[model samples]
Target: MAPIAAHPVRSAARTTLHTVTVAAAPDAVYRLVADVSEWPQVFGPTVHVDVLQEAPEEGGEQLLRIWATANGQVRNWTSRRVLDPAARTVTFRQVVSAAPVASMGGAWRIAPEGDGSRVELLHDYRAVDDDPAAEALIEQAVDRNSTAELDALKKTAELGADRAALHFSFHDSVRVDGDAADVFAFLDRADLWPERLPHVARLDLREDVVDGQPVVQHMDMDTRSPDGSTHNTTSIRVSFPDRRTLVYKQLRVPAAMTGHTGRWTVEPAAGTDGAWEVTSWHTVTLDPEGVRALLGPDATLADARAKVRHALGANSSTTLRHAKEFAEARAAGAPDGAGAEGARATT
Candidate 1:
C-alpha cells in the first residue's frame, strides 16, 4: 500500500475539547479509552473497529481502521494510537481521512479526583481544503463524537469493575430445510416480533437510509418477564443483506446488564447441502448492583449468570424455531394457517 499524501496543515486548523468527572477509578476510565474494540459498545458513534497492527510498546499501542456514524453519516478512517498507562492517557493521529477531513489527532486524559476520576477528551483537526463549509462540517463531527464518547465512558466506568461479575458469551443455532432469504427476512422484520414471538410484548422500530439503502435500524423492545411483567430496552442494529447477518448493540440495556451485544446470522448448513442454519451469538456484561436488586441479596454471581443465560437463550431459541417453521411452511407451499398468522397479519 502507498503512503497517504501529506496535506499541509493550515494555521487556522481548529480544536475541540470536552471534559467530565465521574465516580470511577482512573485506571478503569483509562481502560475504556485505550481499548478501541470496546468502543462500539461504549460509544454511540463507533460502529466497528479493525486492528491493523499492534506495537510492542510499554502501553500496547496500535494502528486501527474504524467505521463510525457521525452527524447522520457513516464514515471510516485509519488511525495510530499510543497508550500511556502511568499517565492514564491515550493519544491518536488519523492516518487516513474519509473526506473533507485532512488530518485529525487527539488525546484522552484520565486524572485522579477526590474519590473519583476526571476525564478530558481533546481533538485537533484540519480540513483538506480551505473551504469554510468543509471546516464547519469537520468541527461538527468532532464535537458530536467527543461529547458522546465521554458521556458513555463516564457511565461505563461508574458502573465499576464489579459490573463484569456475570459477563459471558454463548450462541445457539437451528437448522431448517427452507430458503435462506426467507429466514433472514423473518429476522429482519423485527416490527412483527410482538405478534410472532409470545415473549415480545411490544416493539418499536425505525430505519435510517443512506443513498436509498437501509443501513441502520433502531429498535425499542418490551419483552415479557417471567412474572408476567415487562422488560424494556433499546438497540441499534446494522444489517448486511448480502451476508445475511444482523449485528446489534444495546443502547439501553436491562438493569442487570451494563452492556449487551449480539448478532443473528444465517447461512447454508454444512454437508446437509440443502438446509440453512440460523444462529444467535450473544454476549453480555453484567452490573453486580442490579443483579443484587433483581436476584436478591442471597443470589451469587453464578446464580445471576445462570438466570441471564437461560432467559436470553430461551428467547432466541424460540424465535429461531418459529422462523424455521415459518420458512419451511413457505417452502412447502402450505396454506396460511394459525401458525402463520403473526407473519401474514403484519404484512
Candidate 2:
C-alpha cells in the first residue's frame, strides 16, 4: 500500500467505525498513535501506551499498556506491537500471556478531505476465549477509542492556521519553423535561453541528473523596465519533459511584493488569418501578506493573463523579424552570416 491514508476507516463489520472530526492534520493523528507516552496527558486513567523496544527500521517492535472494562469485569493486558510507519499500520500480538487478546491489529490512516484531513482507523479482531459475541463487543470499544484519539489529534493540528498554496509554470519558449526535433535542438540549449530571453539573465545549474537534465536550476531573472530599475527574483524549477511543463517558484523578490509564481509555455496554435502559430505564455501570481483589511487577500490572476498576452505578442513579432532575416540570408546563399560575427544563423 502506498499509505494507510488512502483507505477509508473500516473496522470489521462485526466491529464499529466511528469518526469524530477533529481540528488536526493527518501527521498529528499518526503521532498520537505512535507515541503512547503522551496519552496520559490526553486521557487520564483511561489509556496508556508504553514503547518496549523500538527497532531502527520501520515495522519495528513496540509495547503498549492494555486495560479496559468489557462486561463490568476489569481486564488488564499488554500487547506487542509491530509498527510500520510508512504504511501507518500496526499489528499487535498478545504478549502478557494473561491478556485475553487472541488477534489484534489496526491502522491509523490519514486522507485529504478538502481543506482538512480525514483520519481513519482499520481494525481486526478475534477472541482468545472462543467467544464470538465478546469479539464483536470488543470491536465496538476499539472503534470508539480509536476515533477519540483521532479527534484529539485533529483539534491540536488545526490550532495552526491555514497556509497559502501556490502553483506556477514558466520558461520563455523559442520555436523554429522546422519539426519538433529541430526546434528542440535550439530551444533546449540553456545558454541560448539567457541571451535570447529578455528576462532570463543567468541560469546556474545546481544539480544534474544522469541524463544531464537539471533537477534544480538556480535562476536569476530580470524584472527591469526600459528605465533601468531592477526587480530580480531567484526561482527553482522542477521540469518534466514528457509533460512539457516547467514549474517555477520564486525564492527571492523585492521587499514590497509577496506570493509570487510564474509559468512560461509554448503551444502550437493556428494563426487568425493563416499559417501555423505557436504562442508562448507567461503568467505570474502574487499574494499580499501582513495586511488584514476585511475580505481574503487578492491575487494577480488577471495581471498574469495580461502579461502572458503581451509576451506572446512581443515574441511573435520578434520571431517574424528573425525568420525574415534568416530566409533572406539563406536565399542569398553566402554561408548566411559568413562574413558577420556573433551571429546565430538559424536554418
Candidate 3:
C-alpha cells in the first residue's frame, strides 16, 4: 500500500485537551477508555478499531489500526499506544498519519474526584507539511471529536452498568440479482430516501469533497417507529465506492440505545456472476435505564434487546428487499427511480 499523502506544512505545534466529569467512579470511566475495542460502541466518531498488537496485562505498548470520522471524512491511521491501568492513563502516538495530517498523539486520563470521576483527553499534532490550513483542520477535528467523546463517556459512566443491559451485534442480508454498484447506489443515495423508503419521513444530507470526490456524508433523518413514534437521527457515514461498503455511526441514537453503529456492505456472490448480497450489520450497546423508562418497568434486558433486534431487522429487511427489486429493475435497463417503492406499490 502506498503511504498516505502528507498535508501542507505548519510551523508551530498545537495541543488540545478536553475534560468531563461523570457521576460514576474513576474505575468505571477507566474501564471504558482502556477497552479500545468498545470505542465503536461508545464513541460516535469512531467507526472501527483493529488491534494489530496487544499490550500485556501489566501494561506496555499495543499497536492499532483505526478508522474514524474526522472533519466529515473517514480517515485511517496506525498508532502505538501505551496503556497504564495502574495510573489510569492511555497514551498514543500515530505511527502513520492519514492525509492532511503530519503526526498525531494523544492521551486519556481518568482521575477520581470525590465519589465521581474526571476524564481528560489531550492531543498534540503538527500539520503534514506545516501548512496552516491543515493545522486548522486538525484543530477543528480534535475539538469536535474530543468534546463528543467526553460527553459520551460521561453519559455511559453515569449510567454505570446494568446486568439487564448488554452489548450485541447482528446482521441481516438480502441477495440481489443485479450489479453490485446498482445495489450500493440504493444505499448511498440517502437524499432520495424519503421517496424510496416510506419509513423515512425526511432527510438532510451534507457531503465533504476532496479533489471533487465525495469522501464523507453527514445525514440527518426523521422516521416513524413501528408504534408510530417519531425519531430523529444524526449520523456520519464514510463511503467506499470502490469496495462497495459504507460505515456509519449514529451521533444521536433513539432513546432505547446508548450507542449505535452499523455498516452497509455489498459483496459479489460466490460462484455466480451478476449476483450479490447486501448486508446491514449493526452493533449496539443497550441502555437499560432508557428501556425501563421508555418501555415501562416491566421491560427486561431480554425484552429491550429483542425490541432492538426486531426493529432493526424489520427496517433492514424492508430496505434490502426493496433495494433488490429496484437494483434488479435498473440493471434490466429501467430508468432511475423506477419501481423505487418496490413491486408492492399499487399506485
Candidate 3, pairs of clashing residues: 8-129, 8-131, 9-129, 9-130, 9-131, 10-129, 10-130, 10-131
Choose the strongest candidate by TM-score.
Answer: 3
Instruction: Write one digit per residue (lDDT tens) for candidate 3, span 1-347.
Output: 99999985446678888988889978778888888878888777897776999999889999998878788777888999999989999999999998788899989999998889888899999887778888889899999999998998887777665522577899999889987767777788787788888788999999777557665788999977777777899988877777788888888988888788899999987788778989999988887779999899999888988998988788878889988988888878888744433321111
Per-residue lDDT of 57-89 in model 2, one digit per residue for the tens? 555887765543333233446777776677655
What TM-score does candidate 2 reach? Answer: 0.36
Tens-digit lDDT track of model 1 for 156-230:
887675546656789999999987777887888898889889999999988776567665787999988666778
Pick out the ten consecutive residues of candidate 1 with the lowest summed lDDT.
Answer: 338-347
lDDT of each: 0.82, 0.46, 0.83
Off by more than 4 A, model 3: 1-35, 47-90, 95-102, 109-121, 127-151, 154-164, 270-274, 333-347
Taking all chains together, each candidate's TM-score versus the true structure is: 0.72, 0.36, 0.73
- Highest-scoring model, lDDT: 3
TM-score-better candidate, 2 vs 3: 3
What order do candidates take by lDDT, descending? 3, 1, 2
Off by over 4 Å in 2: 1-16, 55-59, 68-74, 87-91, 96-101, 159-347
